[model samples]
Target: MDARFLGIPELVEVPDVAVVVDVMRAFTVAAWAFAQGAERIVLAGSPDEALALKARHPGAVALKDGAPAPGFDAVNSPGRLRSVDLGGRTVVQKTTAGTVGALAVKEASLVLCAGFVVAEATARLLRTRGCDGVTFVVTGEDGQADEDLACAQYIARRAAGTETDPAGYLHRAGASRAAAELTQGVRQGVHPDDVALCLELDRFPFALVAAVEEGLMVLRPHAVPSPIEGPSPIDGRPL
Candidate 1:
């Protein structure tokens, strides 16, 4: 399989498999939400659309970043979501980068939203499905999102059967300006533990696959088959 990396969503050219990454928080939050038992997530292009979607599906939970929307249940923070039980509920999520990037790839045969939390699972799924090529979309605009870029690279390496130590990538991501903003409490609605939560590499066992259903981009967790030798090691140690 061949791997190609692209920065920003606008440059994507409808590749066979597209892995849209947002490591600072968006996709990380989605992965944690799924781990917390969320049934599915509907990605909205904007906060207003998220509210509208929530209104249409009365039981759905709406989430966004920064300021709180009128009817949103919560903002996009995996730290805060850690305690919420979302078993069997639909999440309507609108984010600045992640969700937008995932929705932007309208023509890819497979669209998977990813972060370090689901990187390995995503690569495993790609191999299992026999995808000959993949394009990793760094959702951060203008190639400025170092965290997202690191995640895309890590996933690409994993897909190519490279045994990598994710520590270096994690270090690069941790030093990014976005990470500083989150750690310094500059971004509202973000908890102190949000950064740590976002950096937990390969925390989830499934990949978040996106598809349009009834005019909404829906993300569902698809479990990848486990290796016979059990979970792979990270930096020569068990994950």
Candidate 2:
């Protein structure tokens, strides 16, 4: 299958399948939440929409830039996900780029969320789904962030039946100028821990299937063939 990367605005039309990537935080957090038993995540194009969705659900969790909104259960941090119980719960997720980009693709045959955690599972599904082509939407600030681009490239390579040490993708992305900026720490308004969590390749074995439901883009876990690495107390195994 042919795979390519496109920025949000550059995508004039959808392809056979569209995989939206947000390696810096958004998708990475979603993968972790699902791993911890989140039933589904609802993606909103804007914060107002997310709040409105929460209003409809009453107790549903809402997040902004990965942090928990008031009255929400938890934030978007993978680390925080480990401390909470999301089993059978629905998550309302709103982000600056990832969710918005995924929802904007009104014509894609299939939409999936991608990052290093679910990259392997997503690639396998892309190939097995009999898609003629796959487009990876890299949600970059200037429509070009290294981390997002690296994730898209990683998925593209995997779909083509090629190999690249997934860790290498993290190394390159971590050193990128965009990612570098986040490393400045929370004092600078960037959470380094969150960024570190995004780099954990293959940390989960489930891919998120995106679909429009009740006017919201819902992302549900599509389990792979195996349990992957079951989260272990020692080191969070089987990713």
Candidate 3:
């Protein structure tokens, strides 16, 4: 399998498989939510979309702009959700990077959201599926970020069956300016612990595989090979 990394949301020709990376918080939060028993996560590309989804499913947890939307359960903060009960619930997350990147590639055969939490599982799955061409989309707000880049690099290398040193990438991720700035975004109610959670590598063993149905992006938890149920349908509700 051949893999390439692309920045921003451009689709000159979307690849056969796209792995969207948003290590700062969005995808990472979704991973944790799934681990804590959330059934599925809907990746709404904008705040208004998330709000509209909430209007339909009033009990869904809505996260917008890295903060909890008013009347929502929690923001895009893994730490905040650490103690919250998410079993059998649907999460509507609208982020500046993660969801935007996932939504941009409308033509990809497969779309999976990633962070350090699901890096290894994602790589293994890609190899198992025998993906011919893979594009790692880094949804960096400023066009690039260490957290996103590191996660992409890890997956790209692992998919190619190459040895990877995660320590260096993890270090870069924790030391990136984005990590520092987001930690201080306490002004936006972002706690420092949330930044730490984003940097925790390989915290989970499953990836969030997505599918577009009726123009909406929906994600379901995916694991390696036999246990995997392929991707979610656009209109399929979370499990």
Candidate 4:
């Protein structure tokens, strides 16, 4: 169970048992929607596509999308979704990061949806499954900064049976200094709170495990191992 950090595109060659992450929004928002009792989530790569899916499944669900281009229900914002009610309905989400990364990893043996919000459950799933050659692909705007790196470091430490003082890795990864100027950093400008959210171990129990059906990324909540714990030296973060 060897683990090392690789840039997003660098993941292509590795055998992927990936837990795709986009904590700032995307995946994090999905976790929230699931927490609110959404039955399933479909990760659409673009806003237009998500709307189309919603149109096809109207009255039974809600659809949302966000893109720099106008006309989306809303941009990917967890804060925006916090007050919404999604009881018993599925959600279709389209974002630039989470869904795209999930789709790219469709080639992997096991692709589980992950975010800072559910870091604990994710790591628990990985340890329970005993994954080999795991890859964490960060889908930046064009693939850059990728807060998934924080979640990955958390998982990498656990997979190898080691401990990582995140402050230490943040220093090593130079995220500390970068944090100062991060109001304008990589992968479409991720904020400091994004880092905090992505690393909150065991905050939720949502994992979007899925595959590309036909051409769309379809997701289902993965079964998480029981009694998830906080960051641990033995089990680490998931996937």
Candidate 5:
């Protein structure tokens, strides 16, 4: 069966395998956490729940996000996650949309957390694994589709053995580049550096697959370092 497409917010009712994208940050940060050596990630549905989970996990890093607080660990920046020491530790995260969307898709046969940072490898995985009819859920902002739809369409095209076409994805119904642009525009207003960070393709060789049974997320690194993470970069030095 071929995979179908659905907007991220609509996933609350669907019953199919899902690929969750929050490319601007949430899933990107989650992938970064894994790259930074996090053992597992507990994606919370709300900020309050994340705080509660933090209290329960003791010593586990917690990120509570409620209406854009500046002091708290905002779970929206991949750059922030890069600096943290997640080595063998758990991270409890809440975000404006991504984490909640992941929870919504928890009932799927497989819920994969994805981002444009790992786009190519993720698409390759689907083809290699023969994933059919997977749904691309772009965890949109305020019921509007986010830039995640670009990532989703990129994956879908790859799965269908088609070439990359950003416009094709952006122009489709329920896949609004305008919504994505608005979200990215907001990010630009607050932190332009992050906008660039989120656009870099295939920086991490790993894919963070949602491990529902264990109530955690798992990272699977591709066999080779992504071109972005060239030998010089991984050779204990900058590339």
Candidate 6:
């Protein structure tokens, strides 16, 4: 299996499998929402589109970040989403980085939204599906985003049959400028617990796969066991 990494803007051509990562914290929020029992998530390119999707779907909830759209149900933060009951409800998500990056890769046959929360499951699913090649798309700043880059590298290492420890990569991401800004509470609408939530490695045992259905990028979780021997430990808890 071969793996290549690129930023969203660098994606001139995408491979069979595309793993788009947004660790701080779009994909993380999506993973948490799925863990909270969301039925499905629709990725929108803009806030207007997300609102429209929610309106069309009736029960769908819209989530977004930056310059709060009047119709959005809430901000895209895993910390805040943890308390909301999304059980069996569809989510319409429009983020500045994550969703846009996933939609940009129009050439990829398969698109997966990834973050630390679902990194291991994503790698295991890729292996199980016998994908010959994979592309990791870092969605922040066309690849300059440290947190996203670190996540892409971690997933790449795991997919390559390496028994890697996530601490090192997590540390790198934690020290990034984005993390620092979020830590200092400078980013508006981002919850204080969002950084910690986003950094939880392998917290979910499912891969969030995106497929183009009816001209929309719809994401759904697929369960996949860890590639490693035992359940991966997270914050003294077994996943």
Clashes of 4: 6
**Residue 21 of model 4: what lDDT?**
67
Give a tens-digit lDDT track for model 6, residues 29-73. 999888777888999988888888999997899999754558888
Stretches of model 2 off by over 4 angstroms after superposition: 66-73, 186-192, 226-239
From the highest TM-score down, the ranking of the candidates is 1, 6, 3, 2, 5, 4
Per-residue CA lDDT of model 2 for 83-180, tens digit only, reads 67777777888777888788878467799888888888888777767777788888877458888898888888887778777778888888876566
lDDT scores for all predictions? 0.85, 0.75, 0.78, 0.61, 0.64, 0.85
**Which run of 10 residues does model 1 get worst, by summed lDDT?**
230-239
Runs in model 4 with CA error above 4 Å? 4-8, 11-14, 60-72, 141-143, 166-199, 213-215, 227-239
lDDT of 3 by residue, 1-239 (tens): 77788886455676778999999888988888887778778878677778888777757877766444565567777777787888888888887778888888756888888999888878887887788789889888544787898889888998888998889888988888778887667336476687778877778767789887666688888755324455433223331
Q: How does candidate 6 score on lDDT?
A: 0.85
Tell me how far candidate 3 lies from the true structure as C-alpha RMSD in angstroms.
Answer: 4.1
TM-score for each predicted model, relative to the true structure: 0.92, 0.86, 0.88, 0.74, 0.76, 0.92
Rank the models by lDDT, top first. 6, 1, 3, 2, 5, 4
lDDT of 4 by residue, 33-74 (tens): 766667677777666777777777664343443333333444
Each candidate: how many clashes? 0, 3, 1, 6, 3, 0
Better of 1 and 3 by lDDT: 1
- RMSD (CA, Å), candidate 4 to true, equals 5.7
Clashes of 5: 3
Candidate 6 residue spans exceeding 4 A from truth: 227-239
Worst 10 residues of 3 by lDDT: 230-239
lDDT: which is higher, 1 or 5?
Answer: 1
Over 4 Å off, model 3: 225-239
